[model samples]
Target chain A: MMHPSAGGVLKPACYAKPLLRPFGLAWIVMMSVAATTQAAPEALAQVDPPTADHSQFEPLQQDFASGREVTRACLECHTEAGKQVRASIHWRWEYRHPQTGQLLGKQHVVNSFCNNVTTNLGRCTACHAGYGWDGPDFDFSDDSRVDCLVCHDTTGTYEKAPKRGGRVLQEPVKVHGHPLQPPDLGKVARNVGPTSSETCGSCHFFGGGGNGSKHGDLDTSLLDPPPALDVHMSDAGAGLECSDCHVERAHQIAGSRYQVTARDRKGTGAPGQRRYAATCASCHGIEPHPLGSDPAALYQGAKLNAHVDRIACQTCHIPAMARGGVATKTWWDWSKAGRLDADGNPVKRHDADGNLTYWTRWGEIEWGEDLEPDYRWFDGTMRYTLPDQTIDPSAPVPINRFAGHHGDPAARIWPFKMMRGKQPYDPVKDRLVYMQLFGKTEQAYWQGLEWQPAIASAMEAAGLPFSGEVSFTETRMAWPITHMVAPAEDALACGECHARDGRMAELTGFYLPGRDSDPALDRWAQLALAAALLAIGLHIGLRILFHRRRRHTE
Target chain B: MTRTVVMFTGLERLWHWSQALLIILLLMTGFEVHGSYSLLGFGTAATLHVLAALALIVVWIFAIFWHLATGEWRQYRPTTRGLAAVVRFYLYGMFRGESHPFNPRPKRKHNPLQAASYLLFGVVISPLLWITGLLYLGIDLWSAPADLPLAPIALIHVAAAYGAALFLLVHGYMITTGRTPTAHLKTMITGREEIEEASQREQQPERG
Candidate 1:
């Protein structure tokens, strides 16, 4: 309870003097007894306050000497490096006791994963080292595992490990781990611009937990370069590095909430709140579009409008020339059923069924033919016949069945032989009448085969009796099937389907290929002006009424 | 007959109207910029915001010169006497229709509260906005230096913006503290205001 500033609240003279010593000792003992009694009237036993389970705490291993040793070792080559390390957060990774919020320093007794009373040797030292004492488990004397190069590079190359192995032979591994290596000192230390889709995807692509923890599927294969994803990086062809957007990597690694300062290229500090765009605009330019124009408009009106309409610009245009490519969501069947074919190629097709087919090739799909059926009605029912006799009924067929009838089966039946009442009836007329009326034949006497009633029975069951064979005219669908107009809910104008900017508005929302139109942004301008005026008028009217009433009263 | 005519010069009135209009525009645009309301129709709103800001800067330049030449800057000089009184009057007394301690005149138009508010608007809020805006405008020209940190600058910009927003809220509330609460606002519009009776005016002469 004595303050640090007070020299000596407890005097040695009082305790050492023979005459007063006894009285002082007795007084001290009496006071102690009284204080103890007052402190806890019910105290029959003493209990230690619960500390962090520090059975893991131990003497510093030989590997981790004092920070002084590490500093000295680092100073042997680079003296200022220790200062930088001191400013880093890794030096202070200890946690406070959860219950009391007390700094549980190295002396705290705790258990290790091994449940031993010895100092925490393995688990704690992995990240935190150089401390003389640790939890009961670690030995402070062990210096073999203390890696100085985890952050510091003494070799002047940023490589974590030496790349000595060649294509033909592997080099002998060194006993001592390789030293730290800094990047090329001569090269300008440019920040990696904002983290791009490629950078994010390098860690988050298809095989990387598709949409597992990330907000969206970062698989470059599945999605176009989304606008939210580094659009500027893709469009401008600026070589942006990860460190540019993820600024202050040495100070604040990703995922930590620690804040850090950023400077524009010229060192003028960023304006307003430190937001995502504040760091992003350092290289990508302040205004996203030219002259603060609408980005969507510029993209739609560009010479590459077809390309832009088909795919987002960012998908292909990356921050750097090397990074540019059509980004797609790598279709990882999270099911993880073997993705590759027998030859270790990505299985392009599940089977010939086309139902569950996925093509590995990028870009547009080439559509071949539109062998869709065009049925014509000759009687009550519709039908179309294929010319190929080898076509199997069970095999899946791409049939675009239009709603119309084929010729009546009563019109044609081949090789009629049956006679009705022996009047030498015309075989063609009788055969045609029988085939058309009944949609069946007793004559399959041709081709040396007997007549079958299966087809007729099947048609009757399906409520569509085959009337007659109607010929179909074939046509081929074009490559790069750009437009597939199916019946949608509402009749969309050309504008609705296309972008509603300058060019589209000028074209009056019509989808005429290769024609450019200017959009009507003035419509929005008029609306804004009217709204602003209305607000001002309301504000002014209120002011006037209030003032007029006040004057009359005065 | 001592007419209060020509008290606020034409340029002063122009500055006042334009400044108010620009502030409103800036606020609206700023809110939209922050993704608050889609009022100005995003793109055009942004365009108008820059235009109005340029207009405001021009108006501010002229107003600064006018104030310097006419020595009308004294209107915003803050004083301690009746400072607490003016604050208290606005805080509680005005609600009960209490007579103000600082009355408006040609010589001393603004009360202590008004002067303090104007000082904050002119010195702190306006400058902070202007500096930040200029920084934003010239971001390309003045690149962020490698050694210099951006966090502090961003913090200052955001902090100043919030401070201006707070000032605006207080200014709006004080606007309602006039005789019928709109007396001061009327004068800003019509460039004319009716004076209090001579007896009332004499009772509450300008405080130091």
Candidate 2:
């Protein structure tokens, strides 16, 4: 089948033609015969053929014109960008602000390219103008200043239409003030893979206080061999992004809501919440603190290690909701209330000299006797005894010091009998004296086991008639105050009772009656005064120093 | 009979030039990433390195499709007898300046050594670099579970990077071992090489 041409040239077309001879000849003959046969027939027959509507189709030229119009509409929305001029830090290139009393060219506030002007300069117009601005003078007052091509160029041509065409057909309005750039759009779309991070770093790493502009200290290179900073990027296997830690600044300007929130709540929350969107808790959880407990307990216990037991997990690790107003103190203020009585009721009593008395009881008798007949005291001691047991002559004798006045007067008694195997109890023949005083009445008498005036007085104070045989075992003086008690008297009034050789003289040496009278309030007042004086002094000194420095500099 | 031209198009030359430049750049930058060399001075090196790597990726995507559609992939298929002869020629005969056993043709352009190297580079080395580089990029985006260790992944990435560097050094040396000792280099630059008629049609058997 191969046809040999001159100079060893084999004809490919001629070789293939021979293979198709049978089919080709049959096709030609059938076509000729069918044409002649059909020519004389169907002269009298009428038929209707179907047709399609073409009204809906638009010309390609119309579509192209509309696309151009869409671009113009975008420019209209972003007017400042249309003039090809912006009021950015790049243009100002200075270090200080004329207004606002702020340093103009400071590293934190200035853009990378322009130290004098803020990042809000117009250089960003080329990259960030979402819509094209259309105005004679490029007035910012006009809303249609955003250019779609600035950020939508997937073909890498800055001013041309996007290579992928659906961009213009989508919502074309400038919904927000500034349109997000390409890197931002990529992130939102999630269309690109890990390489998208490089797009973000292109601008984020440069300008302002970012890594790029600080003397090339910030690396913007993404495709290079793995960099140390790669560990910080989302693609570097660490899953971090520029936006993970930084938020809000757009076109190098830091006046967005993110900046406001970050500055306003500084030092008030956890690291993750303070920096990012508070979404870190979704992954980290309330790690350091216990969960589902009162947050106030945490703040209260923050200073004391023991207090931490009551804190919840979210308190320290995550942002905890304050129980009360944030400014309110978490600690209880004891100065707001007076001392409580035996049943935790508020005490309201006065002595004969009209001095307020505060007291609580253990069981029956009053413990803190005021030495005034009308004053009531509640004692907090219980008394018990083992009877028929004698004390050795050498051992010290035990006594019920405040039997009738402070505690249950009718003390419980149990008889003691010497067992054969137990130790022997030899009774010593010695005179025993029991003193029972209730409300300044002293009753002391000694009898073998018979009725004694002291015992009778105790029974009477205890509200029991003297009928049973009584023997003493052990008696204790009861003082029921567990927590510190605050008296109603002010610091000045304390001297009336606490003077030398006065009613408080017996307890003065060890007690320092005046000090104990209102310790907490007095200490608090002294501290407050000292703090105020120190603060005033510091303020005055600093002011003087500042004024002197200013004068010297001037 | 189809006549094969010795000259290549400008686009083909551009692609080859860009690909070679990017591969060298990627290798150097990649080595620095492993803390191997101090060249490119870490920060600058890294930036340029990543940029070069990205350019390489773009170039590779286009080059691979071009090679396949143009039927140029046949050049990379390893042929045992052809490859052994090419190897022996380079190891022994090349030293004596003996004539090469195989000649360049449009359908069969690569020598056996070229075929093997290209296969290894395209199929093994390139994919390994890509996977490791991408993994290193997003390590923090999603951390492995607390129980899983990160050392293995890091090891794989680092190992592949070193392997690529080694391959690059060898490839650079091989490019110099052509006819006239600089013929391959010149061909890459001008996209043309002389072919001897006797060696053109001795089709070598397939290699591993």
**Quick one: best DockQ, which candidate?**
1
Residue A517, candidate 1: how far off, in angstroms? 39
Q: What is candidate 1's local distance difference test score?
A: 0.35
Task: State the lDDT of candidate 2 residue by residue for B10-81, as single tens digits.
Answer: 777889789878877876765554444455554345456556776788888998899889887777888886
Tens digits of per-residue lDDT for model 1 on A452-505? Answer: 232233223324434433211111111111111111111122222123331223
What shift in Å separates residue A18 of candidate 2 from its native position after superposition?
Answer: 94
Each model's Cα RMSD: 32.0, 43.3
Indicate the residue-level lDDT of A539 in model 2. Answer: 45
Q: What level of docking quality does candidate 2 show?
A: incorrect
Each model's lDDT comes to 0.35, 0.35
Least lDDT summed over 10 consecutive residues: which range in candidate 1 chain A? A415-424
lDDT of 2 by residue, A181-282 (tens): 332332222121121234444443433222322222223443231212232231222223333333322223222211111112121133224232222222
Off by over 4 Å in 1: A1-329, A333-554, B1-7, B36-45, B141-151, B197-200, B203-208
Q: What fraction of the reference interface contacts is present in each model, in order? A: 0.00, 0.00
DockQ of each: 0.02, 0.00
